[model samples]
Target chain A: MAADKVDPIHQFHITKILPINVGHYDVSFTNSSLFMAMTVIAATAFLILATSGRSMVPNRWQLVAEMSYSFVANTLRDAAGKAGMKFFPMVFSLFMFVLVANLLGMIPYFFTITSHIIVTFCLAMLVISTVVIYGIWKHGFHFFGLFVPSGVPAALVPLVTMIEVISFLSRPISLSVRLFANMLAGHITLKVFAGFVVTLSAAGVAGMAGAVLPLAMAVALTALEFLVAFLQAYVFTVLTCMYLNDAIHPGH
Target chain B: MASNVNTTAEVHHGGAEHGGAFPPFDSSTFASQILWLAITFGLFYVLMSKVVLPRIGGILEARHDKIAKDLEEANRLKADSEAAGAAYEKSLAEARKKAQAIASETRSVLNAALDAKRHEAESSLSTKIAAAETAIAGIKAKALAEVDGIAIETAETLVSTLAGESVGRDEVAAAVAAVTAK
Candidate 1:
């Protein structure tokens, strides 16, 4: 195995430059940052083109655009209730951005930010932070009471509250891990099978004949991964909506 | 063929065991992950809100308008059909009434024609009866005159034969008067 391939953790690398050091943090942009910027620009251009003309009766492109809106809108309404409307734009933007990113990652040689755990973790952290801030802002200090269930006996309050707080704190870790693991696993699976096709073809005639099954499997898995990509984005958005619901209506 | 060969290679080598790609978590990997997460989140936010949601809403509203217009058109057609049905019924009834009036008129005309024919036939029959009565009266008068001449001849022959001699008219007249008296 090559030196680069032998290093287990070295697969994920971050290069830092001493361009201009901020007071506390290293805010230098990297390849990942560049792709993130590209994703945003691409997303903006896509929407602008889709809704260039505001027709009463939408064209095929506009129809697709509207369906995406209603799907997210209804999802938020169902999961988060009337208060969800306040965060509709946020949740909508989140779904669209993730969906595009995941789809873009499927393209050859495109950098899939979602495949990285740090990317997923950061998003989860944002949601968790928003939940905490919104909860405290809406309920004041009483937001701490969220960990204590209503109608519970005083004797169990401490234990119950500890459990609730642990669960709440674990949100970012679990959310990030779920998405990162799925994206990473799916892509790696495709690559390994792809690698087999090359290696087998290079071998004898028998190896070439044997490559057909894995190639077929890889094709099927790729299609499935596409579905998974869409589903994960949806699940992430729904979870965000549910968490926002907690902030909107605490105590339960 | 190559795809098949690749399958055996991946299976034999344990494709899932590509463990080098993902290893234990470390500080650098963690930081990179967070940075990517922030970037992706921001990108998604703008795309959905600005582009996707509005387009979806427009489609839904347009569909709703289409459905509503279709229903309105259906209602109008139903009303028109009902009106047409009523008009058809009215016209049918008027035709039936006109048919009945024509039938009654025809019956009256036929009856009047029959009465006039009966009256003409009766007048012609009465005129023929009157003409026959006049002819009979004329024949009866001629026959009475002839009978009077033959009765005188026969009486004369009978009186001569009975008296065996020529008898005068006064004697015959007296005999006829006696017989009449008796």
Candidate 2:
């Protein structure tokens, strides 16, 4: 290995393309920020194009937009009922952003913001805080009683409350880590197998034969990763709805 | 699962602990993360509220219209079937009445034929009885005439034998006449 060889993770880092200092923190725009902006622009353009020429019977593009809307609408309705209508905009937007970002990252050399724990954690925190604050606002001080199981014996109320509170706090941790770990591990494994293919191809005929297996595996993993990316986004959005449901109806 | 995740996390932290061997978890990424969240959030909000929701509302309204149209068509078909069924029943009733009228007409004709036949038979029987009575009266008259002739001849024969002489028929007859008169 060369002394100056860069680590793969460092390649993923978002150092400012045009360095700028803001107070003590380095808040200059980076490659990750650029892609995030691009994702927003692309989503806006796609939705506008899809729905601009709305037809009574719907064309192909219109059908796609309608399906995407109804898909999220129905998911929220099923998970949280009529109470979820207020949260529809938030949930639908989250799904589109995550879905678009994950898909865009598949393009070679594009940064995947969702693959970073800090990014995933911030989103998770937003969702968790929304549910907690909304639940309190909607239910007032009585929302604290959500931690206590109604049918339990009085003797065990304290223990059950503690367990419930701990579980409640674990929500953001689990939600954030689930997305982050899947993206990080999948990308790293893909890189490793790609490294294997390169290393073997240089070592003559015998090495080429060995390269065939890892190359096949790499191809398979890439397709699987793409599916995982979409699935993880769906899981994150759906779990957010479930949490929102508890917030709306705290007695349950 | 928890243990496995902890071990992975331990490895990640362990790599950093052993003298900057690996990159430490960067705190600087926080700003970028927040920026990305905000941008994505705004993008999604505008797109959904303006473009997505309205399209969905249109589809729902269209589906509702289609369902209502189908129900109207079904209701019309049902009414038509019921009307057709009623018409068939009326025709069936009319046919049954016509059949009963034809049967009654045939019955009346049969009754008239039977009455006429009965009258002719009674007349023939009465005529035959009258002819038989006339024949019986003629037979009695003939028998009475034969009996008168036979009584006169027998009286004459008897008188002639008893007297041992040829007594004239007129004398015998006269004696018989006198005795009959006394």
Candidate 3:
């Protein structure tokens, strides 16, 4: 069996589709870009087409559309109260994009956009920046008060403040890494198991029988990946809501 | 199928090291990925906030308003029916009172009329009884006078026959008078 020869990480390779050179930057359209566009198109089409009827009693498609909208809206309201709703569009976009991208990645030979740290990091950075900018804009210098724990003794204030600031700043790093690592690990695990099935089945009758175990495992992992896809999207959006809450109401 | 798998595996192995070590770590595609991400996400956000969300919100609002209106209409109708029921009960009570008054009035009038008729019948019966008693007394008195005359004649005849002689008129008349007077 050539199990060791199979490379699971090979699936994440990016290929250039259309090259666009701008003086110093190599901003060529890639497979990741295509899937990202597809995600946007799918999300937009679902929302627009479903709501076309706008019936008081919604159809199945309209129900799905409404559920997605309210899901994010309610999440925002719960996490940050009514004031957090102002960022609904941004949060909704992030959720749908990540959700679709993760699901698309589960398809054989499709690239998982969220698996890339660059993409997830960019999204996380966006959330963190929005929180900081909006917090400062709304609260002025009082935004710094978010670092100081209210009940802490004066002697330990400096230590607690430093730790708080560090934790607050680590929000984006942790958020982006969580989604990226989950996708990357899940996809790699599925690929490794699938590769085992392929290599074993090529070895003859006994090997083909042995391949069944990995095949079953691959199938199960695929199902788990689907769940992780949804869960990660939820986790990402909810964390974004909590961060936005800090922007709206600092120090708590 | 075996060859296909072999070739794919070969390509994967061949591509692993040279193509890029962990494609995400390759800094080359980050710019394009971020660029397209921004573009796509921006467009999605705009469409959501400007069009789709508002439409859904409007539909929900419309349904809520319609339900509230229907509820209000139902409440109003219920109130109207209750008022009508109250009015019907009031009229029924009034009618019953009116009927009772009329019944008592008619009963009193009938009782008065019956009493007057009974009094007239009693007075007429008493007068008729008095007249009948007077007539009966007159008849009895006449019958007694006739019986007395009869007795006196019979006695005179019997006395003359038994003696076998014609008696003198003054003696006979005196004898009849004494017998009748005794």
Candidate 4:
């Protein structure tokens, strides 16, 4: 381990597992894909099997499943109202996927799926696209009213609407960037701190004592990272709900 | 640390340089990542909406309804027990009243019988007292009449023997009557 620098960025690197060339596009099954698959299976299995008992009095696993269910349900209801519940599956899927992936990434050496901007972009796009499609479909041309807020002065209408449009367009970018950045920064910081401990402790007795600081920081950061993991998921879901709200009642 | 990171990045990238695109921002991996995300997230969505979510919702709803039903049943039972308790109290009160009535009736009946017996005994005692008084009166009158007669006979006999002459019967009678009267 001497002179070997801990590469914080290495963990996020996507390596081809089973390469699949799809007509000049390399959509190879990578470690990222494996983890996604794992996330899907894990989330599905846990949610399904835990509630298999369907007991009137829920056990621990069932209780967690129910709590998460109601948590998302409440979030969706609060943000978008009952009409937004039609997109519950999509919102819930993204939340579970992000949450599970983030937690899985907490394991040492695990590739974080959410750390990638493209993945979060796709999820953000999914939410935005749903808002667009459903908004247009449900309310027709009236959905465009979302950009025009009520009670604005007639002179500022154009300016306010343009700002609204730009803001609306930036939703996907910000949504993706926020989650990606949080996870990316957290994981990298943890790795760098851990690397410091390793590099320092190998130096000397004094270096080992100095390593304790980073070590403690690493432990504290790990706890914070876990919180960030759940928080990001919640934020993502909440934002998704809010975006879906635009679709349900665009005038508001 | 900087040299080491650069050195490894160089070696790892086949000398693709130190400032090459970070893996997260890498465009080459986007296609693969997007494809897989769609596949996995789509699968998860389908599984949740189709199977898992509804199942969990059903469980929660069932538990909710079951709890409500149990509560309602408990309330009903409570009311039922209260009704039975009220009925018990009512009967207890009725029985107490009936028992008091029966006791009073029995006491009154016994009292009537005792009064009748007392009255019969008093009347019989009064008749016996009257008979004793009448017998005493008869004795007393006979004694009194004998005393008067004895006094008159003795007086007449004294007068006759002293005067050496027998007294007339009518005069003796008249003399006895006057002495008795006085």
Candidate 5:
């Protein structure tokens, strides 16, 4: 057994690359920042390259681009109707960033940006804030009616309202934790299985034979993680649309 | 197996010691991560809203309009050709009817002309026949009178020759008449 070994959790560490200080505030560039930029660049390049031709009779790449565009567009339309399309940019960017981050994390050496609670929480905060601010702006005092259930018995109104408020407040927490936990757990499991492969293969030939099982499991988990990557992005975008629907129409 | 267990334990210990209790719980990097997230998200939003989405939307809208316009034009052309075809068919039917009417009228007119000509020829032939019959009757009466004179003369000559003297024409005629009556 070696005293120093590679740690699976260490992949989640954020190290400062360039240090900047302004009045005791640390705003240095880091690996997370780099990946975020890369996500943006990758998304931008993909969209630009795919649509550069803008052919009416779309080629394969254009079809893919159009499919993704219409996918989010249809989801928003279905979840929140046409009014939800106003936030298409925000929702699309969030989905792409998270999706690309999750996929990139599957690479052997790349960091998983969405695995960090800060990133997921920030995204969730943005969604909740938009809902709150827009709801108040659009509905004014009537927005509070969202807490009241119309079919409730008069005696149970307070209890229903309390439950509604609690659920409402928990939206950001659940949204952030859902994505963060899934990514974090998936990445950890993959690393552990991969570690098992490395450890077993380092043993005798018999151990190497056993290592095939963990390697196969890691491979299967990877495939599952790819599906999860896409699913989580879709879930996040769908929930964002639903929340926006609440803002647009602030009643139960 | 013992070595494998030892390495597994060391891996766990190393993960906890070196990578902290949880790498995400490390607070030193939150500010930069959030800041960069905000910046990158804002950039992406701007690019999507201002540049990419509108372009795609415009292309889609353009294609929709083109398809609709092409369909409308095709419908118009089809309708126009159908109308022309109907008009052509109607005119063809009318032409056939007119030709048939002309042919029947011409046949009737030609038949009437032939009937008129035949009637005129028949009337002329009947008049000619009546004239020819009247002439034949006159010729027969004249021939009878001449024969009477010749017979009287011949009888007078014969009587004169037999009696050795000339007889009178009035008497001979009276004698012939009496013998013919008997």
Candidate 6:
């Protein structure tokens, strides 16, 4: 097999289209940046244009836009309550970015932005920082109360507090890793199964006949990857809402 | 087609020049990814907050207000129709009552005129009958007196003719009267 055909990691390569160094940082415009820009632009255009008519009885695209709005709105509201509605813009942006980025990645030869740990980590940190800043800002020192469970026996307070602190601190890592790993692993698995088909079919008639199994498996995995794409985006956003809930309520 | 991108994540692209550093784990890409994430996400947040949300929310609120106004208008029209229907029913009942009163009054007036005519006709007929009865009584008395005189004359003439002798009118009258009396 050719070297390019052997490397699934090649899909994730951030080829620099333009180099733009800011101070000491290598903040070049890469393929990753390209897809991120596309995701936002596409999302923005769809939302803005879909509602342009402001039709009482919405058309098909308008309905989709409205449903997306209400869907994320309800997700945030359910997790964080009415007060959480204040973070709607931030939460909604994250959801749209992740969802669009993941689905865009499903296209052949397209870059999956969320597949990178740095990207997902930053998105997760956006959520975590918002939670910490808003929680502490709103509740002052009382936000620390989120670490202490009210119903726990006094004997286990120290132990439980330690566990809560670890869990609380691990939120960004877990959240980021969950989405990044799912996208990276799913795409890799699909590529492997699909590669088996190509490698086997290249051999001979007997090997060509054996190629159908992996080919069929690849087809099913593609379908499953599409689901994973959407699911990971949702998981990331929903976890974001839950973390934001800690900011609004702050009490266990 | 993405399935054809090869398997084995173990095979890192040697061309990337970052050596064995995995693309995701590569810290060199982090700066750009973070920078782009901020820019794109910031733009999205601004667009959503400034334009899209307000427009959609306005459309919804306007629809809600319109629906409420329409319902209030419908209720007012219903109440007006009911009032009109009640007035129609009341006037119809009054007209029916007036018609009944007029009919009764006309019948009473007709009956009174008819009774007066009947009473005058009956009284005039009774007076004429009483006058006819008195005249008939007078005629009957005169006839009876004439019949008595004729009977005395005939008796005198028959006696004279049989005896062939003259007699006094006074004596003949006395004899005839005595026979008639007997």
Q: Among these predicted structures, which one has the highest DockQ? A: 4
Residue-wise lDDT of candidate 1 within A1-252, one digit each (tens)? 222222222333333322333555445565556567677777677766776776776777766666677788889999889987888988877777777778887775566777777677777887889889999999888888778777889899889889999999999999989988888788777777776776676678999999998889889988998999899999999999999988888863
Better model by lDDT: candidate 2 vs candidate 6: 6
Q: Give the TM-score of each candidate.
A: 0.72, 0.70, 0.82, 0.88, 0.79, 0.74
lDDT of each: 0.73, 0.77, 0.86, 0.89, 0.86, 0.85
TM-score of chain A of 5: 0.94
The residue-by-residue lDDT of candidate 2 on B26-141, one tens digit each, is 66656655765676666668877776666667766877788799899999999999999999999999999999999999999999999899988988888888887788778888
**Tens digits of lDDT, candidate 6, A125-223:** 888999999999999999999888888999999999999999998999999999999999988887787778877887799889999999999899999
Model 5 misplacement above 4 A: A1-10, A20-26, A192-221, B1-19, B118-182
**Clash-forming residue pairs, model 4:** none
lDDT of 4 by residue, B121-166 (tens): 9999999999989988998999988887777688778888898788
For model 2, the superposed segments whose C-alpha errors exceed 4 Å read: A1-11, A18-21, A52-61, A150-160, B1-24, B75-79, B82-86, B89-182
**Off by more than 4 A, model 4:** A1-5, B1-6, B14-19, B131-135, B146-182
CAPRI tier for the interface of model 2: incorrect
Best by lDDT: 4
Indicate the fraction of true inter-chain contacts that candidate 4 also forms.
Answer: 0.80
Per-residue CA lDDT of model 6 for B10-64, tens digit only, reads 3334545377577899998899999998998888789878877776667767766
lDDT of 3 by residue, A69-187 (tens): 78988999999999999898889888888998899888887889899999999999999999999999999999999998888899999999999999998999999999999999998
Candidate 5: the clashing residue pairs are none
- Put the candidates in DockQ order, highest first: 4, 3, 6, 5, 1, 2
Better of 1 and 3 by TM-score: 3
Q: How far is candidate 2 from the true structure (C-alpha RMSD, Å)?
A: 9.2
Superposition TM-score, candidate 1 onto the true structure? 0.72
Clashes of each: 23, 0, 0, 0, 0, 0
The fraction of correct interface contacts reproduced by each prediction comes to 0.39, 0.40, 0.72, 0.80, 0.65, 0.68
TM-score of chain B of each: 0.60, 0.52, 0.68, 0.73, 0.69, 0.64
TM-scores of chain A across candidates: 0.88, 0.91, 0.94, 0.95, 0.94, 0.93
